[model samples]
Structure formats: C-alpha cells, structure tokens
Target: MQALRDISGRAGTLLTAMVFVLLLTAFPATAADAGYKAKPEPSSGDFDARKVIVDHVLDSYYWHLFDIADRSYSIHLPVILIYEGRFYVFLSSRFDHGKADYKGFAVAKEGSRKGRAIRVLADGRTPDPDAATIYDFSITRNVLSIFIASGLLCLLFIKVGKSYRDADIYATPKGLPLFFEPLITFVRDQIAILAIGPEKYHRFMPYLLTAFFFIFFNNLLGLLPIFPGGSNVTGNISVTFVLAMFTFFTAHWYANKTYWKHMFNMPGVPLFLKFPIPILPVIEIAGAFIKPFTLMIRLFANMTAGHMVILSLTSLIFVLGSVSVFLGYSISPITVLFLVFINFLKILVSFLQAYIFTLFSAFFFGMAVPKDSH
Candidate 1:
C-alpha cells in the first residue's frame, strides 16, 4: 500500500517537471513569432501569406523576437564561413536582416543560395561566381534550439540519476525519479525486453531511452506557440536523418554473423532464386536501407505537417481580412475553435509518434540479434 502511494506521488512530480520543461523550452521560439500580431495594415501593405508561412517553417540565421510600429526586432546568431581558404566570422546582424553586405558576404535573397550567406561581387548585389564554393558553418536558429534542448535533457537526467543514487532501495521514490521510474521501466520491460529479448535488451537501453525521451520532449515543445518551443527540431529532415542513421548503424554494427548471412541468403528460399538472379538477397539488402529511410521520413513529415496546418489556419484570418473585415471577423472564432481542437489532437500525436519511433527502433534492434541468443 505504501509503495503504491509512493509511486503515485512520484508520477505526479514527474508530470509537473515535464510541464515546466516544456514551457521553459517554448519561450524562445514563441518570442520570435510574437511580432506576427504587429504585421502591417491590410489597407496599405501587401501580405504574402506563403512567404510568412515559409519563413516561420524554415530555419533562419537570426531569431526574430517581435515587431513594434513596423520596426523589426531579432537576435542575430554567429555566422562562420570559409571562403577561398580564408575563415570569416561575424554576427548575422552585420547583414542588416538581409539588406546590406558585410566583409564581402551577404545573405542571398534568390538563386540556389536563398536564405544562406553568399559572397557578393564588388557591386554588392550580384553573387560572385568564383565564391560559389564557400562553406558555411553558421549557428542557425534550429541548431541553437537543438543545443538548448540537449542541455536541458542532460540536466534533467542528471538530477534524476542523483535522486536514485541517494535513495534507499526500499524507500518510496520521490521527485524526478518517481515520475521517470515508471516510464523508464515501461521502455525497459515493454519495449526493450519484448522486442530485443531480456538477455540482449540491457545493452541497448541507453540508446532506446535517449531516443524515446528526446523525440517525446521535442515533439511536445514544438507544439508550443512560444519561443524555444517553435523551432521544429524533430521536424527538420537533417535531425531525423541523423537519428535514423544512429539506429541503422547500431543494429548493423553489433549484428551477429547469422544476421548478415540471412541478409544475403535466406534459409527457405528456392535454390534457383539464389543462384540465377539472386532476387531474394537483393530485396533483403534493400530492406535494410528502406527501414531507416522510413523512420526518417515518418518523423519529419508528421511534425512538419502539423506545424504547417496550424500556421495555415492562422493565416486564413489575414487572408480574409484582406478581402473583407466582416469575413475575417466571422472566421476568427471558427478558426480559433479549430486551432484549439487541433492543438489538443497534436498533444496526443506527439506522444504517439515518439512511441512509434522508439518501438520500431527496438524491433529492428531485436531483428538484428540471433534467435540462439534469445
């Protein structure tokens, strides 16, 4: 009875901590979009709905905070470039929000390098053909968000670890550990053990735990309309690609000889297929790459689509306002209602997507292990 009460208390504490972290991570990204309400009047200025949506969805060199009286405010990140064997480092502010060039480099507004730093000719507008090969290593908005999320995760787990280390084995868990204990146990017992089998599951727990929480937290944070939350870390293809690659390499690198043999030659296949066209082997090899590819696309597409849908709905107000104030006013409440519903639905999806990704990863890991080991 006491253990049950203690477990409940810990779960509550963990839920509270999770909410606090989500809010903390949401502020930066939300702040950048705060200026949206201050957009120019519909009567006097042009509003490109597509551009506004795209700008919000894509990563930027500078983090926009808010706008006031038609003035823009933003945080300019550091830009590092290697051009013609010389390193050039400067604040993104030097480009004056894509208006002016500094140190012979400007933010390209068109061509293949749009939204990226490019070397300009003496005219200060035309892109330099010679400097086309410039290498950029700028700290863009998405990269900064990733760093922030990672730091928070490290601090969070460290605190949980300490709580466990200091507590007595028979003592009721409290604080972070209490909340995370059940979740950690679920991943271990339900995910790792069931998929990878008990004997081999322990080795993969570290990665499985990390991937699950990382996706789960980032998905929740992305749903927030405020600062740090809006960065769309998981929605970015590059980030998902890297994560999928981790699973890919982890499975193949530690796979036994039996796993590889099965890939090139199946046990029950007809003899002619193996010797003539080798069709079965070819399909198996392709399946290995295809599995990871699906992981990357599934995560990237889902998160990105959610953000786009919300933004598109929000844009509908301005679009109608441009047509008729009455129409805009009429649609506002409906739009808000839909927004509320979708936001709630997104919360559920955030957890579901995280679970799906982690489960599939575990299943793949299990497949790599030989039946003899189990």
Candidate 2:
C-alpha cells in the first residue's frame, strides 16, 4: 500500500508539472486578450537576476503565462481597492501588466514598496508611504493558487469521504482514496496518536490533517515554474501567521485544568517561589506565543530559502548568457544538472517541511493536554 501510494503521489505530481508546462505554451496564445504586448518593459536593467528571481516568487496581480520573442502574455486578475469610502473594482490589465497607472491606483514597480498595489494622488503620483489611502484586496497570484489548492482538497476529501461511507468491510478503496489512505493512517497513527495520546488524538485529527495537506500541497505547487503553480503561498508570512494562529488558539482552547495548573503553579516548584515574583508563570505564557511564532518562521524561512536557491541557480544561465554567448553555452550543461539536483532536493524538502510543521503542532497540542494525571 505504501509503495503504491508513493508511486501514485509521484505520478500526480509529475502530471501537475506537465500541465503547468502545457499551460505556459498553449494557454499563453489566448492570454493576448488580457493585454499581451510585443514588449512590455517594466525596468531598464538588461539582466537583473535578483529582480527576476524575486518577482517570480512574489505575489503579482497577473498570472504570467510566458514570454516568447519579446512578446509577453499574462492573465490579469481582479484588482479590488477601497479608498476614501468608495470601492473600486477592475481587472489588473488596466495597469498594463504593471506598466501604467489606472484611476488613481498603480502597481508599485520600484523602491521598498515594489510589487505592492499603491494609490496615486490627483496628479498621478504615489502618495507618501504613511499617507497612502489604498486598502488593496486584490486577488493576486498567491491568493488564486490558494483557492485552487483548497478546491482540490475539498474535491479529493469529499470523494474519499464518500468511499469510506459506502465501501464494505471486505471491499477495497479505489482511486484517490487508495493514494491518500496510507498518508491519512500515517498521520493518525504516527503523528496524532503518538503525539497527543490515543484518547485525545481523535478530537484533533481534523485540524492536523487539514494543516498537513495544505502546507504539503502549497509547497509542491510553489516549486512549479509556471502560472497557477509558481506562487509561493506557503512562503508568504501572512499565510503562515494565520496557520500559526490556528494552532495557538487550538492549543489553549482545548487545554484542560491540569494544563492551566502547570502553567500557573508548576509541579515540584516551591510555593514561595510562585509568590512575590510570578516570573515562572510569565515565562510559561510567553513560551506559548513563542512556540507558534517559531512555527510561522520555520515554515516561511524553509520554503522561501529553497525557492531562492533554486531560482538563483537557474538564473545563472541567463546571467551568463547576457554576458557572452560562449560563456552561456559553456555553463548550460552544469547549470541544468545542478538545477535538476536542486529540484529533487526541493521535492524532498516540501514533504519534510509539511511533516515537521504538523509534527510540532501536534507536539504542542500534546503538551497542552496530557492524558495521565500527575
């Protein structure tokens, strides 16, 4: 079962990658409707590897399809902003792929606020950083990638749930359930039950499963180099902060009296030490927040670092090509081989990170609710 699941998961991942490549080649031809142009220059640099790498990994208002023969193609996303009491809605294409401003709003193309949605003044200039009145609620690429992954999880689990409900004891599960069952059982037996204890694990299964798959899928999707898969949702600090918040609230919300007791008046500590100081309890409360803060940083740092490394390695080919054709040809093979290795390493890291995040969360939950009375 484990072997089959591994093969199936790998195949599914490969299929998703192929789909991305196809979308880049096939779908770009249609993206012209969304404002494809022969040449849309957003900068003056000939080859800025840092900018290129950073822009690809960061959220954008359009899904960049491809650039062939200096012709750029992109699918514009909705740009929603609230300014001064009025709501504004328009397709991001109005910004001309971040090349122009529209209706007193523009994409910040340079400076510290680069890649952000900004509001312009009556004379069409960016307002002072603190004085900007825009509240952007645009559906950027990262947001779209999240919605796609979410819909996928819903569909997969809904099918699996029905299978479990309808299947007989002797009948075997089929299709996606076959691929997911082993993973589900591993999380249940290896992670949840082992960390939280069997008696209390069941209550937390839903959260554990949801978080594990959400992180895992986003990590994998971020590794792809085309639209719909290139957005680094997992690496986004806002997303990680929200995930950590869920774990933090869950840990305290389900905490028992013993849990509170341990925090306020820890076992084996002197009663006199508790009074007059209250230092230990203060430390315990801070520790609670510190735990989730670590979760946010760990996932974001790992995912973002992996992406930076991969992009940097890939950029070498272009960076060299811009200098000299001979140098580019000489380095292409080595660069490609290194990139292949990095891609494989990224795949492994994706799964490992997902496991680590979920494991630590379960550990925190275990710490909060102990089954045995002291």
Candidate 3:
C-alpha cells in the first residue's frame, strides 16, 4: 500500500506539473486573442516607479490580469456603497478605470480622495467632499482574495476530513492528506502541545490550525505575481488586526484569576510599589494589550515590507530600461536572480511567520491557563 501510494503521488505531481507548463505556454496566445496588447515601454523621466510599485501592492477595485498596449484585461469586481440612506450597486468597470463617473459616484483619483469612491457634486463638476460620505462595502481585490483563500480552505479540510473517515486508521494519508497531515501534526505537537501545554492544547488545536494554515496559505499566495494571488490580504493591517483580535479575545477569555492577579496585583512586589505607585501591575496590564498589538504589527510589517522590496527590485529593471533599453536588458538577469532569491527567502519567512504567530498565540494561551492552583 505504501509503495502504491508513493507511485500515485508521483504520478499526480507529474500530471499537475505538465498541466501548469501547458498553461504557461498557452496563456500568452489566449491573452493576445482576447485583446491583451503589449504594454508600452516607460519613457525616461516620465516613469514614476513609486506610483507603479504602490499600485501593484495596494488593494484595488478590480483584479488586473495584464495589459497589451492600451488594452487591459481585468476582472471588475462589484462596487457596493451606502450613501444618504440609499444603497447603490454596480460594476467597478463602470468607473472607466478611475477616469469616469458612475451614476452619482466616481473613483477618486487625486488630492486627499485618492483611491476612494466619492460622490460627484450636484452639478457634476467636482467631488462633494462632505456628501461623499460613503460606507463602502465593495469587494476589493484583497477582500476577494480573502474569500478565495477561505473557500479553498473549506474545500481542502472537508476533503481531508472525508479521507480521515474513509481511510483505515492505520493507513497513511495519500494525496492532499499526505501533503498537509505533516503540517497539521507539526502545529499540534510542536506548537500547541509544547507551547500551550498538553493538558489544554487539544482545546486550542482548531484555532491554532486555522490560523497557521490561513496565514501560511495567504503568504504563499501573495508571493505569486498573478491574478487571485498578488493581493496583499495578509499584509493588510485590518486583516492582521482582526486575526490578532482573535488571539486577544481567546487568551483573555480563557485567562484564570492568576492571570489577572499577576497582571493587576503582583504577588511578590513591595507593598509601596503595589499601592502608591502600582507601576508594575500597570505595566503588566499594558503588556497584555501589547501582546496582540505586536502580533498585528509584526505580521503586517514583515509581509508588507517583503512585497515592497520585491516590487522595488522589479521596478529597478523598468527604471533602468527607461534610461536605456540595453541597460535594462543587461540588468534583467541580475535583477531576476535577486528576485528569485528573495522569493525563496519569502517562502521561508512565510512558514516562519505562521509558526511564530501560532506559537505566540499558544504561549499566550498557556500564560492565561495557570500551571497550578494557588
């Protein structure tokens, strides 16, 4: 059975690789036929690398696949807005790539309103800064990526769950199960059990697993330079904040009297320090909030910084190319090599960040659960 499973896995991997190569070969032709035109070379002094890099990394209302000349191939996401007690829904493309207005709303392109949906004035001359108050519920690229990753997670675990039930208890995982079981085990044994303690680890396994896989998968996906992949979902501060909040709530909710007492009233500290100053307890309480805050900022900063550096390197090629096509071509190989190295580093960092976040969460959980009753 082991031999057969290995053979099957190899066959499946080869087949997948072949399909991927075929897609790579065919995508250009299909894109050309679909009206994707070659993008124009950047003119020297006119090329703003900063703008290019920012647009690529930032969240957008549409998923830009590619461009040919002036023609762009993009997926227009839905735009939803709540204004003046009325709800408006439309396609993002209706904004004409941020050049035109849609109904009473238009994409903000300049000034303080950049990258936002603002209401056009009654006379339709300028954006109404006041009345443009909008509750944008639009599904931007980052939001779409989040949904996609979530759906993929559901499909993945559901299949794994089914396999667990159908396969013999002693049998090894064959396909997706084979690929993921080790990761699941690592999270369970190394992270949860070791950090959270075996007595309480089982209860937090589901949260730890969910967080580990979600962050890891999104980080991997963000490294891809293609549609449905490059949207910086995990790098977005809001997303990180929410994830951190989960840990914050879970830790505090499970915290025992000892946890609070240690935080609010230290046991061994001098009485004067505890009563008159109470500095240590105040600091400890602040630390409780700081733990999750650090978690949020740490993940957000690392992932965002990685994306910026990689994009900056790619932009260098273009920047040089703008000066002289030959110079750009000459540096292309070197730039690509650096880019590849960074990508490999990013992959390692992705796993490391996931592990760190999960381990830290477990540590916090353990801290909340007292080792012994006083």
Best by lDDT: 1
Cα-based lDDT for every prediction: 0.80, 0.78, 0.79
* Rank by TM-score (best first): 1, 3, 2
Residue 205 lDDT in model 2?
93
Clashes of each: 11, 0, 4
Flag regions of model 2 displaced more than 4 Å. Answer: 1-45, 129-133
Model 3 regions more than 4 Å off: 1-45, 110-113, 122-125
Top candidate by TM-score = 1
The estimated TM-scores of all candidates read 0.89, 0.86, 0.86
What does the lDDT come to for candidate 1?
A: 0.80
Give the CA lDDT, 0 to 100, for residue 240 in model 3.
91
